[model samples]
Target: MPAVTVPDLTVLPRVSAPGVAAASRPVVSITSAPSGTEGEGFPVKRAFAGVDLSVLDPFIHLDEMGEVDYAPGEPKGTPWHPHRGFETVTYIIDGIFDHQDSYGGGGSITDGDTQWMTAGSGLLHIEAPPEHLVVSGGLFHGFQLWVNLPRVDKMKAPSYQDLRSRDVALATSADGGTLLRVIAGDVAGLQGPGSTHTPMAMLHATLAPGAELDLPWRPDFNALVYVMAGDGFVGPQQAPISAGHLAVLGAGDALRISAAQRQQQRYATGLEVLVLGGQPIREPIAWAGPFVMNTRDEVVQAFEDFQAGRLGQPLPHAEVGDPVG
Candidate 1:
C-alpha cells in the first residue's frame, strides 16, 4: 500500500459561544485538540480530558487516532493493558484493527465498525492493526472515547458490543443535505446497535454544503461536538470550528450545527462530525491509569487486584507478522 498523507491543521481564533442568543443554544466552550500518542506508538489528537477530567462529567477522554498512512513494513499496535471501572468505545472509519482480551475475546474491526468494551470490574486487552496491514501499509482512522461508569455500575461484569456498519442506523433529514448515524443512542426513534449501561448519545453525522441540523437534546446531559473531517458553524453565534476541534455545548434547549463554508470554500466534498452527550454522574472519581473508582483506596485496590491476577487473562492470537513499534 502507498503512504497516507495526514494534513496538519492550523490553529484558529477562539470564538465565544456565550454571547449568542439563548434561542440559538450557543456553544458553552470550544476545546482545541492537542497532539499526543497512545498504545505502543499510536499517534492521536486529544480533544478532551487532558488538563481536567471533571468538566466532561461521565465522559473521560476523546481521541482522534490515525487517518494516517502506514508504509509497508511498519510495525505499530497496542500491547497488552488493563482497564477497570469504565468502558472504552471505538469507532473505526478506515483500515482494520485486531482486538484480543483476557476473556478470550478476539475479532477484527474493519472500516465503519464500532467496538464498545465494558471493562467493568477488570479486563486485560490489546488493540492493534493487523500484522499484515502493518507490514503491507494502509490507511487508519478512528475515534476512541472513554466513558466513566457511575459508582453503582463500576464493579459490574465485563461485556462487549461490536457493531458492524451495515447494522448501524443511518437517518437522513426530510431534506437531502443532512445524514446521521446513531451508534449508541436514538435518532428519530431509530436506536443504535451499540447499547450502553450509561445514558448517552453517540452520533455520527455528515452534512452537505448549506445543510444544517438542529437536534433536540436533554438539558442535563453534558453535550459535546467533535468536528471529524470538515469545518462547521456551532452553537447560536455560529462559532466556526475546523476539523480537529471539539466544542462543548453550553446549557441550552437544543444543539444547532450547520455545514459552513470556509473563506476559501473548504469542505467542498462535505463535512463530518461526531456528537456525544451523557448525563452527569456527580460522584467522586478516583482514576489512576486504567482504573477509575470513587476513592484513592479503590484505585489502590484495583492495582492490587491486577497484581493478584484478578484481571482477565489474554488469549493467544495468530499473527502473520510481528508489529515493529
Candidate 2:
C-alpha cells in the first residue's frame, strides 16, 4: 500500500476541517466487493459491484487489481482490448505495468505511478507486466477505475497523462494523523496533477490507527469511500467498514472517517482508503462489454466499428506478446 508516504506527516500541508456550519455526510449503504479474475486471469475485486449505477454517476467501473504476492513467472495483465466513451485510470500501488495503445499513448508505470488514458472516440490498447517483471515476479497491487464521459465528450480525441507519485498533491489531516495523496481534482485548496474531462476528485488517504479525518467535500458532488486496507468507521453514524468494502454517502459538506484503535496485523500501519466524488452526469448510460454509451444503439455502433477495424489496429510490436485474447 505504498502509493505515497511521508517520513513525518506533520511536515506536510494540513487539510483544513469543514466549517462549523458544514454537515457531515451519512453512510447510505456499505457493500462488499466480489472477487473475480480479469485480463488474462489476474485477480481483481469488483469494487463497484451491486451498487446502483445512478448512485455512481460519472464513475462506471472500478477494480481492485490485487494484493497478491506472485511467484516468479506468475505476473499477469490484460490482453489487447478496445474501449470507448470513457477514461481508464490505472494507479499502481506496487510493482510495474506496461501499457501500449493504438494511438501512440503508452508508457511504463511502476509503484505510486498512474496512467490516465481517455478512450474518448475509441482505441485499442493492451496492459501487461513487463518482461523482467514476468520473469522475476513480485508483489503487484493496484486499482483501475472507469470514468464515464458526458455525452458531448464521448467522441472527443483520445489523450493520455502519466502521473508520477512525486507529482501528487500531498497533505495531512490537521492533527497530522493521516497522509493524503490527491490524484485528481482539488482537496482543501490543494490541486492534484491529473486533468479530467469530468469534474471529479480522487484521493488515497491513510489514517494512523485511532486517528480521525473530517474532510471538507463539495456539497454538489456525490461522495464515496472504498477501504483498500485495514478497518475504519465512516459517516456521521460511524458505520463500520473494512477492506474490500465501499461506502456510499449521502449529501453533505463533509466526510467523516475514523480508524479503529487496532488494525489487522497485516495492516498495522493504518486504515487505507480511496475517496472519490464527482458532479453527477444525470444522463442515461448504456454500457456493454468494454463500451459505454448513452444509448443502446450507440453501444451497438461501437461494437460494429470495433469489428470493422474502425476503432484501431494493434501496434505491430504488440504482436510479440500473446495474441489478443
Candidate 3:
C-alpha cells in the first residue's frame, strides 16, 4: 500500500475551465525547511515566510511541529496570541492539539484532523498539546501554515474549518500510483472541504516504491512541495529529495513527483510529501508577530485593537499561553 497506483485522473479537469494548462513538465529546486529558535515551550521547524526566506507569496509562513517523541512529563506547545489579516491552517498528524479562541471557538484536533482558522480582522487563539498527552507522553508531529488575505478580505470576519481525518478526501494516481490527501482546492478529481479565501491546494501524498503523480496546475499559481518522510524524486530527471527538504517548483504546466526506488541492497519504504500552492497575492507585505497587513500602520492598528479588547475578551477559565511558533 506504499504506492497507490490507479487510472490516470489528469484528464478530468474542472468542466469548462478557461486557460487550460498546456502539457509541460516542471523542474524542482530542493531546499531544506528552515529551523528557528524554540518559541515559548513549542519546538518547531520554520519552513519559510520569515525574514530569512521571504519568497513564499500569498502564503506568509509555515511550521512543522515536532516529529520527535515526548517523554512522560515533558512540556511542549504554542501559547496564546492574537492574529489579524491572515489565516492559519493546522494539520495534526500524530497527536492532539487543543484549540481555544477569543471568538468563543474551541476544540481539540487529534490525529489526521485539520483546523483552518481565518484571523481576519482579529482573533486571539491558543494551540497547545492536550493535558492528557502531556501526562502520558507521545509523539507530536504536525504542520501549521499561514496564508495571506487579499486586501479586500483582510477585514473579513474570522471563521474556522475543522476537518476530521475522514473529511479529507483521497485521490489515487494513475493505476494506483500515488495516494493524495487533499486538504484544499482540487486534487485529481476530488475537491477538498476547505472553503478557501484564495485559490489554493494543500495536498499530502504517500508514495510507495514506484508510485508517481502529475499535477496539472495553473501557470499563474505559485507552488511548493515539502518532503515529510522518506525520500522522493521530482520531475523528469528524478531529482532526489530527502526528508525535511522542500522543492520550489519551476514554471511549467505539470508538477511531477515520484517515490525513489531502492537499490537491490537497500531497504524500501514509503515517501510522504506535502504540496501547497495558490494564486500570488502580489501585494505589499507588512508583518509582525501574528499580524500581516499591507501597511505598517495597519499592523499597528491590529495590535492597538487587540489591546483595546476589540478582538474579544479572553475566557477567564481558559489556560494562559502564547501563540508564538
Go through the candidates in order and give each one's C-alpha lDDT: 0.75, 0.90, 0.74
Candidate 3 per-residue lDDT, tens place, 189-244, comes to 57888889888889888777776766777677777888878777886577888777
Off by over 4 Å in 2: 314-325
| Most accurate candidate by lDDT | 2
Q: Write the per-residue lDDT of candidate 2 for residues 31-138, one digit (tens) a residue.
A: 999998887888999999999999998898999999889899999988778888999999999989999888899999987899999999989899999999899999
Question: Which candidate, 2 or 3, has the higher TM-score?
Answer: 2
Residue 158 displacement in candidate 3 (angstroms): 1.0
Candidate 1's C-alpha lDDT?
Answer: 0.75
Q: Write the per-residue lDDT of candidate 1 for residues 101-180, one digit (tens) a residue.
A: 88766688876788899889988888888878977997888888999999899899898888888877766644446667
Pairs of colliding residues, candidate 1: 26-236, 28-250, 67-140, 75-324, 102-313
Whole-structure CA lDDT of model 3: 0.74
Off by over 4 Å in 3: 1-22, 37-39, 49-55, 263-268, 314-325
lDDT (Cα, 0-100) at 205 in candidate 3: 80
Cα-based TM-score, every candidate: 0.86, 0.96, 0.86
Best by TM-score: 2
